[model samples]
Target chain A: MLTIHCPCCGVTAEETEFHAHGEAHLKRFGPGSSEDEFEGYLFMRKNPKGVHFERWRHQYGCGKWFHVARCTMTLEVFGSYSAQTTEPPQEIMDIIHDRRPDTAAGPAR
Target chain B: MSDPVSALKNIFDDTGLVRVSEIGPIGMVTLRGDLSDKVLGKAAVAAGGVNLPEQGQCNTEGSQGIAWMSSDELLIMCPYADVHARLADLQEKLAGSHALAVNVSDARAVFDITGDHLREVIAKLAPVDMHPDQFNGTMFRRTRFAQVPAAFWMPDGRSARIVCFRSVAQYMFDLLKDAAMPGSEVRHYA
Candidate 1:
């Protein structure tokens, strides 16, 4: 099972104690956005095999939502971060780049 | 008024190494606010006569105790008779701050598990670090009991007090009973 460190509670909780909320850093496409943009915001997902980012809630711990960076294929967690921002912080992005340089140079999806 | 009956009054069991009992019709209030706010701390001391505990910590002074539920929230436990008055006092004391105190005496239930195998019984239900070195006494942890959400803290080495939603009181008690059954691997006293 996965062990996630909750940024808010400062505790490492088991996977069963946390709830995964799918992809993170999705830009909202509200009333003024185009239909395609709205659909992408709601339905489209990256589902990348290598590096991926996700949002998770420490449901049984602090009850606060946080972010996770991991690999889809190997189930390796790079790090955990706060979910208060619309994008992964620079340090987290840098870590991802350091681990997988090939994907770092390319545009972030 | 008739004495308030606890939900688990008749449910106490001494059949196993671990025995469980309901704590009380204890006065419980959930407080939410900025932990950095000095006024919130002031109000808590004025009302409960104790400081709001730090994260994961519990501060107990006589019959009053405060458990830090999270970075910005705390659970205050006091005598049942003092709840209403203390709640109003806290509200009045922190009137202008972005803080809230709500009575949750009936909304939740607290069960005290005391025995030689207390840690073992808890390890069976929750995926938490129950080791004395890793998780010490006076630390409050919010974790799941098997599948039900609960919070627990240890007052000393051999006992624990668990809190959960009132709706799951029966399920929680039964889970503890089964976990403390004879021949469990973690059962130490046997």
Candidate 2:
């Protein structure tokens, strides 16, 4: 029963309305690409054990696509933002710290 | 004869303002791929000039319509008469791409459900919150309607349209009939 924040609707919503798209920030090669290059792009994935950024779709709600940063081990969400935004929302980060006192020591930098 | 399409027609008449029209033989293709990929983007443009709409959104070009069913899936619709040739052209243009275009035209049927209470009727079936403001223009949905797999398109909230597999059309029609008749006893014997 996790409440995920939607950057499009600007509200936390039940997890059922959103779908987790694995690992964000993928790079694509141009046309007439080599076999190894294309294979690497398609088959590679990063299964990080700690804080990671992932894409998610607000499927049943606003239907907008966005990104979320969370700790993979604890499933503690740190922040969420629209795909177009360069930075995550500060308020969301603040709330994350407020709710999880132990993680409030400092930023994940 | 208790046919499903006819049953739908009967319900439409009883509902007063609503009218049901069959958009049969329409060519429907399901496209799946990464939205940000250039190859996928080119394939979408080659299919019809417009990229698939955002999830829950529909893009219409003349008689053709494409709805985004999920982040990586899109439903393509074109008039029955134009399907075969158009699909071939699209397939040729999208060759070698990491996308997959599946022909599902024969597997589905399209129904145009229009009139004032269409939204209310849909609320009785699907789990989506189909409110006027939240799900208006450009909004579409891939959800279950009366326990049938359906993809809905709302040109406007007042007039709702649904496309579903042909096999479940009868089940949906029966659900609509019972819904229209409130407390009436409409039993289905196996």
Can you tell me which runs of candidate 2 are displaced by over 4 Å?
A: A1-109, B1-17, B20-22, B49-51, B182-190
Model 2 TM-score, all chains together:
0.60
Leading candidate by lDDT: 1
* Candidate 2 per-residue C-alpha lDDT over A1-109 given as tens digits, one digit per residue, 9 for 90 to 100: 5568776655355576578888766666558999877886788776766556678987654467898878778887877877875445677567656765565432222
**Reference A-B contact fraction recovered by candidate 1:** 0.76
DockQ of 2: 0.07
Q: lDDT per residue, candidate 2, B60-178, as tens digits?
A: 77667787776677777776556667678767766877778878877886677765566666666676666676567887766667556677777755566777778876676656555
Q: What share of the true interface contacts does each candidate keep?
A: 0.76, 0.00
Candidate 2: chain B TM-score equals 0.80
Go through the candidates in order and give each one's DockQ: 0.80, 0.07
Q: Can you list the residue pairs that collide in candidate 1?
A: none
All candidates' chain B TM-scores are 0.93, 0.80
Interface RMSD of predicted model 1: 0.9
